[model samples]
Target: MLVPMPSEPSGQTPPASSLPGPSLPTPLPAIAALPAYVPGARGDAAVPPIKLSSNESPDGPLPSVTAALADAGGLIHRYPDMAASELTARIAAHIGREPAHVVAGAGSVAVLAHLLQAYAGEGDEVLFAWRSFEAYPILTRIAGATPVTVPLTADARHDVEAMAAAVTDRTRVAMLCSPNNPTGPALTTAEFEAFMAAVPTRVLVILDEAYLEYVTDPDVVDGPAALDRHPNLVLLRTFSKAYGLASLRVGYAVGPEALIAPVRACVTPFSVSGPAQSAAIASLEAGDELVERAHTVVAERERVLAALRADGWSIPDSQGNFVWLAVGEDTGALVAHLGGQQPSILVRPFAGEGVRVTVGSPRENDALLAALARWQGRTG
Candidate 1:
């Protein structure tokens, strides 16, 4: 049986009572308007691709760590140590700091988030360079703090002088991501010292060295070296980049116990799992064998730079395990063109025409070169 209603309703709007539950919270227009985040493409059968979109180590986790993961299989039944004390002790010893001075988290990101939550609050300003790490601003806003963004220089390097000038009395945190994401240029020791000197001590400065291992520059600021001079300087490093433990999600910070203590309180209990802890510890013990990979990536990065330059592509001085290809206005077309290649290499393309190509194994590097060469030939 069919019940028919009038094709043209007898002239009235539905009563307000007919609406579903309460209306959504009055959203922050800025946040509500933000576009959805897009992760890099994965195994798309239609697109034969090599996913280099994220700045991940092309060489996977160390062999010893893999063995540790397998050995830790049975232990998954039990919860990870809530304190993560053993992993903290091991990491602290490796970094030449006391365990109390170290705080491990899911990744360096969790440490950064906790730091923001502990320090910056409503009406506080959090400063960072534009396009440094996208998460900085998002985290700041999430913590009810104002984000003070400073533009990078023409070469895409952090203009430390400009960043220092942007600081205000309300500024609670300042972050510097050296060998910065996307651009890959790091801050010189002198630049960091100057930036620190210019900044007031009340405000904390976090130097994110996520890609520290891939850097070969002698001038780059060593995390431990600056620890003594600046009490507020917190250096954040991760095992994800060179050690290839991204899946394990283990990272720690080296800083004054005052700051570290509050940040630690913000961390959720047992955030880092037992297998991750075992794998991270194993990776740290492996040491030099793991670090040697950085050297290989650096060499490959140079080759990629030269080949791109020869092909008339403008690239930046990448100190990380990745290189940046800036195609200016043609970003979309360029990405589509490059992504369309056979045994295709995918890259992290930014909103504007900047793409980051992670350094891969020798064979993978050669494949990327071939693709870039073909793209250049067609686009030039």
Candidate 2:
């Protein structure tokens, strides 16, 4: 015979012996203090807005990728491969790295979270430039680690030297976002090497190259090529931007086996859905065409930059698929003005700092330029 759980009498308490224990469950204190990650705003559904907020490619996924997705659609009933083995292998081949050194996740952000979990813990410090990827601090805090931020240069580039100096005994992870988000200039190879030399080997450094494919600058540090020279370095890249697979959510990391093994261990099982893996494999197969598309985006970015400068906007030298306006106090007003235009435009704004405008279709770019011209006239 099994013993029964005691129940209290209706509207009355039984003796203390008959009472159950308190059932309230509390979350981690760090979680309560965590800052929410705010994504870029989506426009009105009734009338579609030109979305240049998320830095997504103007062109949709490649033809091969679309066909692959359609083929994979039938397999949704089955669970994704827990290891994401084939995707990992393809990414390794593309980068010329061993399969053991590569790990794929739902997105580069997810892979980054895994890195934080593997290397950071209570009392450890994770360091990066301020106004970089907003997710950095959030992921650090979620891992029960402290986030330390150094200010970016006035020109909106990462102060690599300052970031290196900021690392201390407690610093377990340091992040570098090349073609830094919301700000466009990438870290030059010389600067990156100098920073790496200053950092202790024990401290892991992540080079986030989410927008790297969009970069046309010759001076930018090539993360994969630098990996072998610095065992502590982890290179992160994504399929969302250049491959035009934002909806699929597949990204990868390359580093030494020791570092990568732990990150792989921390990944949630089957987080990289089956369709995502299949699409990524197909995207890799269509690599040359994708590169050509990326070059087109870079070309458009240059055209937009030239136009903005001609219009008297003092923007940074953007190397990614977006331009950053150091709008400062005008951020809210500028964003609102753009949204209020005949065909509203959506952009990513970092309150009081700047606005990031993705390079879109030629017509969309022209619309954005017109809106900016109107705003400038009005404000002047």
Candidate 3:
């Protein structure tokens, strides 16, 4: 009874695996069925390869944003503003909305999750187009709701009529991603208006415009105008995609005060850091500089898109920061080959569907095009 204990060596830590712990609880059944959200491939430290995977800006943050980040670093000991009050005000002024109607989260995706948690629950149906944003179904199920998906058209566009018709009494929310991710064709104003007319206002409609800055098409849905006419309409926007702030998540939603109030309640307290808020506010001040960078990326995207088309590839007219290749069965092979190139180009692939190539800088894009040519030479 008086035996001495075996102690860990001084100045060394015992491995966590060696410790005995209480019985862990099992996760909900839904966790087993959730599809993993695979991130874009990253390069190893040995070789900093060309990165064209994520839909990130090919450029870095603005000078003003960097300055803000440096200044905010000194305040790490303090908690961030839970309400993000100043950020809300700036977003409202930029988008011409009242501060009460705007809410900020770590990212737009987070904002969407908060909306779902507030309005959706077991037995409630959340609807969206198939093969759109990868997080749609995962988020829906996580909210303890069912996901109702309508297939995209043959040409890779939302079948809005089918989606509107699929709405049922149990439907609580519907999402529309403009310049739809991984496929990239923005919804026209007319298409959106018609869809809205058919759906009941009792159901919430989220129009995700994460790629708004990269959109050059004039006929795309007028988001602000739509929000004014539809009480249930809310827009999800992000600073990650084109604002060059992917490292610091900063996104917002704009809608009527009635819906925004509840969504704000669902957010995790102090979810956004002080540095993130600083960068976003500074980004707003440098709107002119942001547009210049967007223009550069848009030009490169057009050039890459043109080259792909000229070489006999059929791709969607992507208005977003990336382009999609609907290579159905050839996805795995193409991605594998691209990853093996001299400098190694990494792109996002949705196995068995196609690949999504971010529009990198001209030099990076050139590397991608060359690798594609090599792949075709061996296979074609």
Candidate 4:
């Protein structure tokens, strides 16, 4: 029998627990408590759907990357390089780091999982700011570590001081998502330096810079440059964003050799496919085109943010390629208005908290802006 669930005020979602409880051999409590991942909503409209739900680049793989993927596809029978040595070397060279400092994985999310597996365990505390990456707490729980979170500052940025202060003997990993997801404000250079200073060196710090390529601000924490000083700090980056290879699932980490070694060891065998590796390398070689595309995304993001703020939405300063709308209880209403429109605009909604709208092509964004205008008319 299905479990009884308390109704949500928005009336747009059924509680996750409303589904039938798991039977047979019982799952672990942490696993049981973990919220099911809610993917960006997809619309079944006859017309093409504007999928700005995930923070994916609107652009596709560059011709070079596509050719590389095609070549690698012919060699699918052979296993991928488990060490991903060539890819690692390319990333290291790009960041002026040695190969020992890098580890390649399926995606940054996979790399994070491996990092947690290597460093955290039962009774340990994994710390991060609330409303950050959805995967942070999930991965912590999966590693049997307790997830601890400090609320985001009013401006929707990390309270690094609070995070550092919250650390205790049991804290194993502390994650900082610059240009934090869902709500989009990055840690400034001074904020990051202060955080690193306040936190103990014994605890590992992960700076997930998945959206790094789109950041136009000159003062966001330069994570790669800070690596030498903070040996405990690791940078997680991906081809999935600016390089436009989301389907390939290629990402990597650069960090101190000691912390990276165990994370490398914990990754699943041959998880990153040959095509993904080839595509990632090719994407790196096509860095110029990627940068141009990233610039366009940033420009559109600024335009969108300006329009939203002019509309009096109270959005934060988003350094990422997406913007956040803290719509609160009206989240469902906003989502419904957008989704119900012709051509159907879909996005990522965090229940009653907010909506994350990825900066898409000019036309798609225009549709989004129009939808919001209509929503405002209906509500206002």
User: What does each candidate score in C-alpha RMSD?
Assistant: 4.6, 3.9, 3.9, 8.3
Count backbone overlaps in model 3: 0
Q: What would the per-residue lDDT of candidate 2 be over residues 1-380, giving only the tens digit for each residue?
A: 56676665689767786666667898889998888898877888899999999999999877888899999999999998999999899999999989999999999999999999999999999999988989999999999899999999998999988998899999999999998997998999998999999999999999999998888788899888899799999999999999988888898899999999999999999999999999999999998999899998888999999999999999988888999999899999999999998789999999998899999999999999999999889998
What is the C-alpha local distance difference test score of each model?
Answer: 0.85, 0.92, 0.93, 0.90
For 244-352, candidate 4 gives per-residue lDDT tens digits of 8888898898998988999999988899999999999998898898899899988999999889778777999999989998989998988888888888899999988
Cα lDDT for residue 297, candidate 1: 85
Worst lDDT window (10 residues) for model 3? Answer: 1-10
Lowest lDDT 10-residue stretch of candidate 1: 1-10
Q: lDDT tens string, model 1, 174-271? A: 99999988788999999999999999999999999999888888999988879988999898988888988887898888898987999999998999
- By lDDT, the candidates rank as 3, 2, 4, 1
Estimated TM-score for each candidate:
0.91, 0.93, 0.94, 0.93
Deviating ranges (above 4 Å) for candidate 1: 1-36, 45-48
List clashing residue pairs in candidate 1: none
- Arranged by TM-score with the best first, the candidates are 3, 2, 4, 1
How many collisions per candidate? 0, 0, 0, 1
